[model samples]
Target: MINVKVMAVLDLVSILQKREIAFSVEDGTTIRGLLEIMCSQYGPELEKKIYVDKDKELLNLNLYLNGRHIHFLGGLDAVLRNEDTVLLIPYASGG
Candidate 1:
């Protein structure tokens, strides 16, 4: 099992109905696979909040695996291990 912690992103919290969740995934599951599962479990609205396009080519949120950014680890292809913690952080912009 892996744990996912969703930061205080209102839209996402509303969709997921919780700030943190734990679920089982097949061993060797990648981050992309995990996101896909979340989309299916929560709904397309969750996908829209995370993905930048219908093609799912870009991520609008920042993903961290056990405190390290996914980009540095291996982007969406980063493989998850049992008991790993993935944190989802929303992007913020103001000027």
Candidate 2:
């Protein structure tokens, strides 16, 4: 198993129930796999908040791995490692 540290912004604290959490994934799990596990653990409400589709074709929030944006790191196929830090930042819209 690989242990990852997940950090969420204040806007997502209510949904996640905590600002930071330690999550365990199977060895060699990719970002997409990790997201699937999280969605299953957190339920439909959280899933809807994160993904625009079940296939993960679109994302409603920004995901960072160790302070680097996932978009530049091979999207969801990025492999995770033990002790890696993941951050979730909710979308913000302003006038």
Candidate 3:
């Protein structure tokens, strides 16, 4: 199974904490698959919190594959391998 680290933006931590969304996905699923699942559970509105537009155009959110940014690689369509580390980090920050 793959491993995912879901990090919320500082401003969006409340939503994630409220929903009890943790920092891991232990199943071998594609990036798109995981995002879809998150949308269904957290609603499409939540997708915009992490993703860019409603059309899923990626914003400044950083998706790293074992420490490599997806944007510098395959973007969101990137494939996942067993034991791969998927880290999703929102660019927003707050004190």
**What TM-score would every model get versus the actual structure?**
0.86, 0.90, 0.64
User: Model 1: clashing residue pairs?
Assistant: none
10 Cα displacement, candidate 3 (Å): 2.4
lDDT by residue (1-95, candidate 3, tens digit) is: 45555555455566555422443454656677767777777775568776777667765477677778877767777766655655666674677
Q: Which candidate is the best by TM-score?
A: 2
> Comparing candidate 1 with candidate 2, which one achieves the higher TM-score?
2
| Native-to-model Cα distance after best TM-score fit, residue 1 in candidate 1, in Å | 6.5
Expressed as tens digits, the lDDT of each residue in 7-75 for candidate 2 is 988567888899998998898998888878878888887888888888767998999999999999898
TM-score of 2: 0.90
Decreasing lDDT order of the candidates? 2, 1, 3
Q: After superposition, how far is residue 55 of candidate 2 from its true place, in Å?
A: 3.2
Clashing pairs in 3: none
- Residues 17-79, model 1: lDDT tens digits: 887788688888888998999899988888888999998979989889888999999999999
Regions of candidate 2 where Cα sits further than 4 Å from its true position: 93-95
The lDDT per prediction is 0.82, 0.88, 0.64
RMSD of 2: 1.7
Q: Which sections of candidate 3 miss by over 4 Å?
A: 1-5, 18-28, 93-95
